[model samples]
Target: MGTIYRGGSRGALAGLRRPHLHPVPSVADRLNAERHELAGAACTAADPEVFFDGTQDATDVAKRICGGCPVRARCLWLALEHGEAFGIFGGLTADERRRLRRKGVSAA
Candidate 1:
């Protein structure tokens, strides 16, 4: 009979080892999962440039899309709170948001 050793050859060690596995989700992963629950947002699928467009036509398109968004209120509130510097958000353009801020108007 061939001699068998406890800690045999390199091939034997590899045979005993399992494949590398993915790490478990971390806290950030959980948070991201929760946030992604809102992934079905209307704006989420729109062209990113649509919101940042400098032309009136493009901005109008973005606004129309936002007008129907279910999360428009939440989006607008966040933009207002953060003092968003540029781009269209929650159906409001940068200039509009500025005016609203100046007027002390709530995004809601």
Candidate 2:
């Protein structure tokens, strides 16, 4: 591109290397998935910080979002499964999850 001195026949970028392209397949295409478990979750479009800010306002906002989430149960199970030590998930705070764990309450 710097200098095409002999440009009588060749067009622009004629000397450039044409790299091979491999387009990435979509999630469903790759996994044969119908849809993600959290596709309809309310929190997907919300501010991510609201889930992990560790502030009362953030926790409240996150809980409100999780209140109507279709995947709330799955979210809670994942949170408890991983033994998450912080933030809000499935409308519950870390303390709430801790108490549940203390009571030997498994996600069912």
Best by TM-score: 2
Q: Which residue pairs come into collision in candidate 1?
A: none
lDDT of 2 by residue, 28-106 (tens): 1211121123567676567656665678888888888889888778777766765656556678887999999999976
Give me the candidate number with maximum lDDT. Answer: 2
lDDT of 1 by residue, 1-108 (tens): 332223213421121111112122222232233223454557655665566556988988988988888877776776676555666667888789889888988644
lDDT of 1: 0.56
Worst 10 residues of 1 by lDDT: 12-21
Model 2 error, position 4 (Å): 46
Clashes of each: 0, 0
lDDT of each: 0.56, 0.56
| TM match of model 1 to true structure | 0.61
TM-score of each model, paired residue for residue: 0.61, 0.62
Prediction 2 TM-score vs. true: 0.62
